[model samples]
Target: MLKVKNALALISEAAKSWYSSNPFQFSAIIAYYAILSLPALMIIIFNIVGAIWGRDIVQGEILGEISRAIGRETAESIRMMLVDQGNEKTSVFATVVGIGTLIYGSTGVFFQLQTAFDRIWESKQTQTNEILVVIYSRLKSFGFILIIGFLLLISFVLTSLLNTFSKRLHRFLPR
Candidate 1:
């Protein structure tokens, strides 16, 4: 009985702390940044994975998954947006600026996540250079994105191999 009461009190305290952190507002902020970041994130991932597979295959797999999660209509809209972004032709300066923008946008969600985590953990940093800190954080986030792209590519290749193996195994076994 005492253990149960102690557990309940601990749970209640944790809940109050979580509620005080304003999780819903943080979630809303993260979602907004994610929406803003999606195009750039997709473009980066497509570029990374497309080099190994093909853009069409990567796009098809990504869109198919998105369609399943959301809907075909939303996926189609995303495809259109990606197409438009790909088709744009720009001058050297504009291209540089666009690339910078894409990197910044792609890292936005991760940056927000870092902020939320810091807030939740009540971490205090004693940094002399704010700009450097921000730069480091963004670079870390970009590295994470690159790792995700690589993992996604590996996953696709592995899945394809597994499917082929499964079919061959079925031929040898009684099913």
Candidate 2:
């Protein structure tokens, strides 16, 4: 079909454009994500220090005032939680809590970046296809990285097993 041919052409052209533009766009995205997350980083540090101290750092007086200036709801919530004592002590430090939060936040940015790139290709559309294909193309390029990660894991396991077996062999063979 003519439409199919046109769509393929568009896809090819989009892929070329995506390849040409990806490095700059991806780096810019990562930089912006780091910058925009400054507020969250503050929240992380405040939470961390609070956990370490076993009390909220920004709950009252001067620090509370500073937090209010930074983020109203967050500051108020932390203040209330600290003062009211309604919520149980988390018994977790900032660095530990932040790992999960960072994972979720980074996952959000990944989807957002995928959406942005797909939109870039969609704007060049000749016919309908899954927007996911553009996203898939980006992830496909990451396959090599994924393979390397898996290989590293396998290598670690194999090395551990070899060490254990060697120890067992030495014991059974009498030194």
TM per model?
0.90, 0.28
Model 2 lDDT tens row, 62-92: 2556575877677676556445542445556
Best by TM-score: 1
121-144 in candidate 1: lDDT tens per residue?
A: 899877879998899999999999
Whole-model lDDT values for every prediction:
0.92, 0.55
Q: Tally clashes: model 2.
A: 0
Name the weakest run of 10 consecutive residues (lDDT summed) in model 1.
81-90
List candidate 2 segments past 4 Å from native: 1-23, 31-88, 91-100, 123-155, 162-175
Q: How many backbone clashes can be found in candidate 1?
A: 0
lDDT of 1 at 133: 83
